[model samples]
Target: MEFRCIQDCSQCCIEREYYPSKKFGKIGVLILPEEKERIEQLAKINGLKISILPRIGISEEENSNPTKILAYQLMGIEPNGNTCPFLDTETSDKSPHGGFPCKIYNKRPLACMTYPLIESEPITLD
Candidate 1:
């Protein structure tokens, strides 16, 4: 079955407070080694700057700061949210899904290509 997103909704783009407890890490995703170079090149070609997130797996060490939890430096990360930088927000209202479309949908990073993947209990997406 095909899964489609709800209209006028971008809840998945938001961030979650990732703690060290349980299955957790930063709200941002990690970019695959294979996709990293491609995304970086594309960002440069398009004049877009992206943020880098470090890799931080679950820590058995005590007093670990979740705030500093790292991951494999993701590309296409939005500053204030988990949404990809290539997401076309302004054109959202005009789209059938009413969801902001990706500017580089065809060539988006592996992470952006897979979204709303439920881990644990399923929650409502705004």
Candidate 2:
């Protein structure tokens, strides 16, 4: 079987969930460390306000701040953390698949490119 996005459905881009727990709040689009700077630049170029937080990190010592961050999350725009900041909600333009267009579609992060397929036990869908 093949997997494809539903036409006129932007559910994946429009909704976020609290990962690990609610205390961490709704997790945003996963952005790899290498993509962080570019994402920030894109946001700046588009005149968008964004919040990026560390999603995964590693440290040389225990209980110490991460010396290197592995991943970051591009937070949503609403208070409940729904809707991607780059979803182009202001415009009426739709994506080729009939969903809201991504402002940075061609330059989207790797995580966004590989959605519904995550590296975990048994390689489950997210």
Best by lDDT: 2
What's the TM for model 1?
0.57
Tens digits of per-residue lDDT for model 2, 5-30: 55335666665557666765677989
> Distance from true position, residue 71, model 1, in Å?
5.4
**What lDDT does the true structure give each of the candidates?**
0.56, 0.78
Q: What TM-score, over all chains together, does every model reach?
A: 0.57, 0.78
| lDDT for model 1 | 0.56
Model 1, span 1-118: residue lDDT tens: 4766553344444444354553544455556656667877877877778765556545556777555443465533543335656555657254565567555656765554455555
- Cα error of candidate 2 at position 19, Å: 2.2
Which 10-residue span in candidate 1 carries the lowest summed lDDT? 7-16
